[model samples]
Target: MSNFEFQLAYTVKPHKPERDETDAALTRQHLREKLGLDTVEHIETTLLGSITLNNSTLADRKREAEKLVHDYIHDALKELRVLSTVKFYGCLMVDGLGPAIRFDILPK
Candidate 1:
């Protein structure tokens, strides 16, 4: 088994009655800067977690990350279900959850 660090991101749908346009705009700005995207229209929030799994391939890790993201979206934040676009990013064998790991993940 190996340690996998995962980050889950999702954008709330604009049509939701509870959605705040201002909050969404701020979220979009924050995520665009964080993810280094040129432009992003939807509000995005990122959640981080770690899991140990038997798989070694990146494909397996990707599947596990997506599954984890889906489970979290379904269970913890049920409101996001069918109303949000989700993504997962994963890296193997992170040294620590501190600066070392974060520096490695940051875009160069």
Candidate 2:
């Protein structure tokens, strides 16, 4: 299993400012389910949000995990129209083998 810590930066449509919290909650739940993550949390304090994904087989590889997360967010945006550009920085835990591999998933 692999653990991932993600720092999320996203924009919501201008008109939907009031739904920010609701949208964020729904996004977190969606990611948890879609990624089959054991744990997902929204640790947002600043304008940027921090998310940690734990115990996920699907996220075992850094490159694949980045693509999966990016694609999932793209698909989720179709239903959750409040989301605009979404970007993230992901750190893949190396299980004490060495330093974690860091990757960035940027908006298209």
Candidate 3:
């Protein structure tokens, strides 16, 4: 008896052509189809060629990513449902091999 949406963002890394396409498809399927969203909203991703350069700008980049993630989810939830109110939270992981910066929204 609940409706929910999830936004998953992940750092982009160099990949072989096949692997890259496969990864993208998988991410879309899991986040959109699995969650049953009408559409998969834009995923905020930055193209920092070297992981080292991104490290220096990590804080700023992450902040921007967070803002986009929240806004996308907030708007989508509002348009999708008539809820009393919707709640949102940004999930971040500083640890290596962490998940892409994303928002988990619950609208009821």
Candidate 4:
């Protein structure tokens, strides 16, 4: 059988302050649309979301991005029926010049 399975959900965010439901809902929607799957897995948000600093350096940009990603995830957690334990692995920047901020999230 394929390794695909279910339990805790892992996802990423590509945008913030979505013009839709709370940021969290936006993240979940993005995942559902992309994966063509329907699920409501509750997970905690650990990336210091919405705490971005103003700067042009790579580090500053990464911090900004990660926070946004986690914020959306946080919102999604509220819509879930069964909540998973949340943990924060850390943050990383998107490859190349995009420097998209991504929060390292894990289901505990």
Candidate 5:
């Protein structure tokens, strides 16, 4: 079996309302500089998981990787109850024997 590493980043809806989009960054900075809370958006969440496939070919791996990512997106949409964009980054073999593949999948 071939082991794959996956990092999924997603931004969910119903994010805290700030004065504007810029305020999100300003708020984080203010908290970090003044209140010492280094937190960005309390809305976004990341899902990290790995998949072990029975195949070894790179072509097969790529197909499986994309399918896995789409599956995550579907789950997020259904369970999180929000539109989210999932980016698939740093897909690599667990044994560190080949080049890694990275890509992004935007929301529909």
Candidate 6:
């Protein structure tokens, strides 16, 4: 089992009429189902938008997980037909080891 914590800062190009709570709920559900994440929480007071994920199998492999998430977000945006961009940051702790890996995503 792996412990992963992710912090995502994001912006949707065209704002939608839906409330932030509704958008957050939908995003959480989508990520939980698509990535098998145990936790997906939307953080308030973040610039534009933010989301966090904790304790997930997705972080079993640190580097791989980072890449997976980066690519996943890209594909998800395309799939949703939404012009959005995300800046992903994460810290992976395996078996109680503190901060095994810390990374930030950069545009390709």
Tens-place lDDT per residue, model 1, 7-104, is 54445333333554444454344444543323323534544556665666765655555554455434432342322432223232232332212111
Model 3's lDDT to the true fold? 0.41
lDDT of 5 by residue, 1-108 (tens): 767655444332223344233433443233234432223345333334566766677677666776666665445344433333222232322233245444443334
Which sequence of candidate numbers ranks them by lDDT, best first?
2, 5, 6, 1, 3, 4
RMSD of each: 11.1, 8.1, 15.1, 14.0, 9.3, 8.8
The predicted structure with the larger TM-score, 2 or 4, is 2
Q: After superposition, how far is residue 93 of candidate 6 from its true place, in Å?
A: 3.8
What is the C-alpha lDDT profile of model 6 across 1-108, one tens digit per residue? 333345443433223344243444454345445544444345521222123344354444545555555566656645643323333343434333245455544333
- Winner by TM-score: 5
- Considering summed lDDT, which 10 consecutive residues are worst modelled in model 4? 1-10
Give the runs in model 4 whose Cα sits over 4 Å from its true position.
1-30, 34-54, 81-108
Q: Write the per-residue lDDT of candidate 4 for residues 8-85, one digit (tens) a residue.
A: 235433222243234445444444554333444344322221233445775655555456455554555535421233
lDDT of 6 at 98: 40
Give candidate 2's total backbone clashes.
Answer: 0
Lowest lDDT 10-mer window, candidate 2? 43-52
* Residue 18 local lDDT, model 3: 46
User: 1-108, model 3: which lDDT tens digit per residue?
Assistant: 111133343332213444354543443344354433344246443211111113235465555555655565455545544222323344643333235665555444
Score candidate 5 by lDDT: 0.44
How well is each residue in 1-108 modelled by candidate 2, as lDDT tens digits?
A: 444444333332222445455665665556545544444245431122224344345444544545555565566655655344333444544332235445544434
> Model 6 misses residue 30 by how many Å?
0.9
- TM-score, every prediction: 0.41, 0.37, 0.35, 0.35, 0.42, 0.35
Worst 10 residues of 1 by lDDT: 99-108
| Residue 45, candidate 1: alpha-carbon lDDT | 51
With a 3 Å backbone cut-off (N, CA, C), the pairs that clash in candidate 4 are 24-72, 24-75, 24-76
